[model samples]
Target chain A: MEAFKETLLSSFIVFENQLNGQKKSELHKLRQKAFEAFEKYGFPTRKDEDWKYTNLKPIIKHDYKIFHPKEQKLQLDEARKYFLSETDTYRIVFVDGYYASWLSLTTHHQYDICTFSALINRYPEIADEYVGKLINHGDSFTALNTAFAREGAYIFVPDNKIVDKPIEILHFTTPHALPAFQQPRSLLVLGKNSRATVIERHISLSANPVFTNSATEVFLHTGAILDHYKIQTDHYEASLIDNTVYQLQGYSVLNLTTASLGGKFVRNNPIVKLIESMAEAHLWGLTKIDSSELADHHTSIEHIAPHCQSNELYKGIFGGRSTGIFNGKVYVAPHAQKTNAFQQNNNIVLSDKATVNTKPQLEIFANDVKCSHGCTVGQMDENAMFYLRQRGIAADKARALLLLAFAGEIVDKIQLPELRQYVKRIFNQKNHIDFDFDL
Target chain B: MLKIKNLHVSVDDTPILKGISLEIKKGEIHAIMGPNGSGKSTLSNVIAGKEDYQITQGTIEFEGKDLLELSAEERAHLGIFLSFQYPVEIPGVSVTNFIKTAINENRKAKGLEPMPAKELLKLIRERMELLNMDKSFLSRSLNEGFSGGEKKRNEIFQLSMLQPKLAILDETDSGLDIDALRIVAKGVNTLRTPENAFLIITHYQRLLEYIVPDFVHVLYNGKIVKTGSKDLALALEEKGYDWIKEEVAI
Candidate 1:
């Protein structure tokens, strides 16, 4: 315990040295509050109810070097290699947790666009207001990220402003010599009657083991609409811990879709807080696991106000000895009447040794609310397999075809033409499935 | 040619085919008629190399090759086909893909190249016409949500595609309607050749009127007690299975 304290204190000192004057001052104040809360509540262990399936000891034990803001040139051709669609959307690139202005497109006239580092330097007051407001500082990982939050992206859509093209922000991590840790944070504020779509991609160029602890806070005001997509396809040696909080106000709509394809260990926590009347949210997620990689998704949808609606569906496909964990909870607070919440988690294990642990829970304090949760875990149907094989398809090819059909349910729901095709391509390449879907 | 000599088989240690023997030469269509629980279906399953039955003492030769020593898939590759009584349903697998796979596997086993997609499609369409099946059946999942008649038609469609040497029909007429029975029998008759044979197992003489057989054998209590020409099936229809049972007892 003493050694852990020393490690935390030293990491904070290193974080302070990497920031400028105004950013350092803001972090100093937030650090003081976060430290107090951290002292009150230490790191969450397996004993904690929410952290039962995922243990963070492996993350804390390693001494991760803080990634400082440095000027580094990125290969533009390589950066644009994976974009599936050709559009006039603005592209922003960040390297090693710091925003790279040279690689980012100019948004001079676009009032809805701003970088996190530029906003922190220009309007410190706006950054100070909503930076750490949505996230719980007592959470050790969140606090650790707050202490070292160097650079990310910030987008604000004013009232009645609709952004036609998706804003793509690419967060790339490059480990030069030693193992590095980067925490890229983003704060999206969608004003009333405004609509926009943001796609956040995390990529790694280095094959060495690295850690990325990312936190994104989305604030949807009354009558606002936001569509968020997170694509995490890092190298197999990389680890990712991402936490996203959606705080919805009255009559706002927020839709979040996440795809986790490549990672050594990935833990995604998506929290939706319906704070006002008639606020709605939808969360859809798909993850494909192979080899010994592990992916865990923990989501919480809280209906704090009356007449709110939320739906969540998460599907996973596990092969080899890989393991997947999904825990979804819907909490309907008191006085939040007429809250309709539905949650479902389904997983298919291809190999005999693969395992999946899914738990869906519903807690309703309001009497008039309709809330339900369900989970299913099973292998492929044998009768179906025999039927296919008798028709003359080899066993292996038949299994692959069924797996693709299983994944089609979620892949078909993606509305973005470019991203949908990109997802299908990635799924096909990774699973070796011969899919002919033209999407 | 197919030959079976004194086949004694048991399922779960219970005797099912007790010293049953039969022979079928090329260009012959033989029907084995029997009542319920008379080991008619067991003979078909055993000939197809199903694992559950134990051939205590039997010798089955197909084209001068030992049949009992081959695996189910191997038997299929060696021109043995069994049209199941109850067809299994597989979702998300199209019928075109299933038939293509089956055809290619058998072709490879016979040291032949895979059929091209264009030619395969042409063959499938021709067979569909022969069986009077719907063209949409080729695109839908294999047997999923298919009606009884449609399932039987699909079985015959597969038979037409495979073109096996010895085809075994195990109660294919059980759930089919009269029209479906006529279409299926027509498909079977069209596929018959001088080098191909068939062993039809049924409980009734209704199907024999469509696809007339050369010989009909009466199976009683796990053994064939009488053998005669096609007229025997007609005589049995007039006189029920009890006549044969009493004659065997005497």
Candidate 2:
């Protein structure tokens, strides 16, 4: 812990010396505040309630250097297969925590789909209105990410303007002379009566230890709709900590699906706050972990307004000593009448060594609210396996199919057609399924 | 083409079938009728190689091959089909996908490539029509929320699709109404070829009125105690199994 703090603090000093000072004074101040917060908390241990099932001390012990590539030197061909290479969509790509403008296909045609670095440098006033506002302050990793936040996706959808194509944000990290550690921050603002689909993916191009502490703050204006899909299928050597906070206005809808298929150790914190009445949000997560990997999903949905509703479903499959943790909480405030919230987390442990901890927490103060939570940790249904085998599916194939079925429910919720097919292929390959049957 | 000799099967170390023997050749339809708890479903499950049933003492030969040595799916690959008494519900796997996987698996075991998509579609549509099933039924999760009649109809539909050499109907007519019973019976009748046989294990004689059985056997006390022509089912339906128990008492 001391090593990480000293490394980060020294890096910040060097980073301060490099900055010219006059124009970047506000960003420097933000970094100083964030660094102070990180120094107070350090890295969370197993004793913390939120980090009870996830221990990051091992990951923190590594000597990770902050990355700074020269220029936009890589080609789209290098990161072609990682993002939407086939389809035409707005794309923002980053390599080693630096935005690659030459490889990116970002546009300001109807709305702004650009880089956060350029946005923050060009128009810090508009960028500061939303950056680092929605996230909670105490989490050390999130604070650390804020301290070093640089380049990621910055999107803005104009009011009453519907973007026809979805946006793809691909963050590719590769170790150069030193093991790279990245802090990629993304901020998106959707105006009223606008609709857009966004896909954010973290991909590792090389087999090196890359730890990314990323944060994204999304703001949904009234009646805005966003279909967000976060694909965390990184290499086994890569670890990720993603904090995504969404704030919704009245009559807004946010449908989010996250597939965490690969990663050595992953911690995802997605918190949603329904700030106005009649807004709705749906959160879905599917994690398939194996080979001693750990995937933890800590989610919270706060219904602070009357007549708001939220639905959440998180499913996982663990094998070969892999572990999974799902701690989802739903909070309905005192005057949040008629709030309907449902949360479910189901897990299947395929091996004797695999472990899973699932907890669904609901705190409802409104007497007239309808809130329910369901959680289950178990093995695959024996009867279902027998039924599949009776139809001539081999034992291994049957097991794969049942696991696919458990994970496919979330995959089926993906809104993009092309992206859905691509995700299914990824899912099949990750789980060792040979067939290409549709979901 | 199925021969069982001196078969004694037990479930959970408790004997359910005691010294029962039966034989059925191709192109013949045989019916077995008995009261409840007479090991009717047990016999069919045992034939289908259900792991729960232990054949303590038996020899089951199908086409001169020992059937007991094969797994359930291996037995299925050997043209042995058992329409389960209770169809299992499999969520997230559609009925069409389930049947496609089953048929392709059977074909693969026979060293054949997967059937073409168009050909499989044509075959599925034809069999679906024969069973009077809607096209929408194919897209639903397999028996997830199906009614009793719908489940039975699906089983018969699968039977027509597989076209096994020996088909064992274990109480397929239990949950059907008159109309559904007629459709299921007609589906089974249409698939009856000269190279395949049917063993209809049922209680009521109403199903026999649709697809007339060539022979009928009385399953009493875990064994077939009486073998006769189709008239035996009618006699049992009239006499109500009590007389059979009394006559077998001695």
Candidate 3:
């Protein structure tokens, strides 16, 4: 851990030197402050309560290359497969932490969809308003990502406008031979009475390990609506740490869903703050992992205002000695009366060696709020299996069907039909089931 | 076409079926009436190849083959079907898809081609109409959120679709209302043929009134103590199983 810290410290100095004389800018000042914070509180270990189930030692031990000098390009045909092939979307793609303008279809008309660096150069005022407002400064991973954030996605929807097309933010790591480390930063803002949809993913093209630490901040103004989905189906050698925070105003709606299907090690931190009355947030996650993979989701929802509502449902299917963790915390302020919050975590452990650990923490200071949570971890239903088998489905096919049904509850909630089919295809591929039967 | 000789079964080392013997020919409908916990379910479950029960001494032959050697699904592939009393709810799998998978899997096991999509759709629509089920019901998850009557009706609907040679109704009349019971009985009566047999397991004689049976056997304490015609079912319904228990004690 110390060796990795020293390496990152030296890399930060070189990263700062390449900033090109923007030292006096507010954004750069924040970067410096974030760097100091990262330096002070290095990587978190298993000793930390939040990181109790996730060990970052194995992920950070590799001497990963932090900078890429040469510009990497992907063929249109090669990159087209990763895009939503069935629907038209505003794409902002990055290759090796560098924006691929030629591969992107961004716009600056009614909506602003571009890279973070482009946002800083063009709309610095907007960047200053929402860039680091909701980030947790005490966390080393978010601080490290902020210190080196430059070329990820920047999406802004102005007031009273509903964008017709969905926005896709894609990061593809094209590592040649050495291990690569990337820090991708994204910011999404929906103005008052506005609406938008965003899809974000991180992919590694090769078998080499690519470690990604990412941070994203979302702001939904009064009467605004935002639907966000994160797809974490990267290579098995890749490890990802994602920190996202959503801040909601009065009457705002935020629907955020994350599907973690692959990756060797994954840790997701999604925090929601209902800052005004009548705000609503729905957080959903589905994780399906096998082998020795580890997927940890630590979510927190803070009901700071009255009459706010939140619903969280996270489900996981573990196989082949995999490990899963779901730690959810809900905090209701004293003044937050009539706060309706419900949370549930359900997991299915497929193999005898697989494991699932789920914990739900609720702190309700207000007496009038309705808060409830439940967690369940068990194997597949034997009665359901027998039912299907008695109907003539083979044992293996029956098992696969049951597992798919267990996951269908979450997948069915995806608003986009094409995206739902894409997720189903990916799930079937991962589980080696031929889902040719007409849905 | 089915025979069970001197069958003795146990679950968790405790005897459930002490000794039972029964025989049925093709085109015959045999009704097994017994009180609760009299091993009625154990008989149906054992015949369906449920792994929870152990057969201490038995020989079950179907179409002159050793039925005990086959798995539940293998038995299904060999033309056996069990209509569950409490049909398991499988969320997310629509009724159409579940039936399609079941039919295709049975075909695959028997070295036959899958039914074409058009043919399957037509067949499903026809069967749905026969069962008095609406089109929307086909899209709902298999038995999920369905009413008690709908589950039993769906079980009968599956029987009509699979067209199995030996169909075991495991307390299929437990939760059905009169209308659902009539529809289910109608489905069974329509599917009966000279090449197939039916074993209806129930606690009441109401279902037999609709679909009259050729044989009514009183199963008491894991053994079939009395075998008679459909009149036996009405007699037991009038006197209750206490008369059967008293006769057995004698």
Best by lDDT: 3
lDDT of all the models against the reference?
0.81, 0.86, 0.90
Candidate 2 Cα outliers beyond 4 Å, as residue runs: A22-24, A68-73, A175-178, A436-439, B247-249
Docking class of 2: medium
The numbered model that scores best in DockQ is 3
Error of 2 at A201 (Å): 0.5
Going through the candidates in order, state the TM-score of chain A alone for each one.
0.93, 0.96, 0.98
Judged by lDDT relative to the true structure, which candidate is superior, 2 or 3?
3
Q: What's the TM for model 2?
A: 0.94
Candidate 3 RMSD to the real structure: 1.8
After the best TM-score superposition of candidate 2, give how far the Cα of residue B189 lies from its true spot, in angstroms.
2.0
- Given the true complex, what DockQ would model 1 score? 0.28
Residue clash pairs of candidate 1: A392-B101, A392-B102
Tens digit of per-residue lDDT, candidate 2, span A259-366? 898898898899999999999999999898889888999999999999999999999989898989999989999999999998999988889999898888888899
The TM-score measured for candidate 3 stands at: 0.96
What residue pairs are clashing in model 3? none
DockQ, per-model, please? 0.28, 0.58, 0.80
Clashing pairs for model 2 are none
Q: Tell me how much of the true interface, by contacts, candidate 3 captures.
A: 0.86
* Cα error, candidate 2, residue A337 (Å): 1.5
Model 2, residue B142: distance off in Å is 2.4
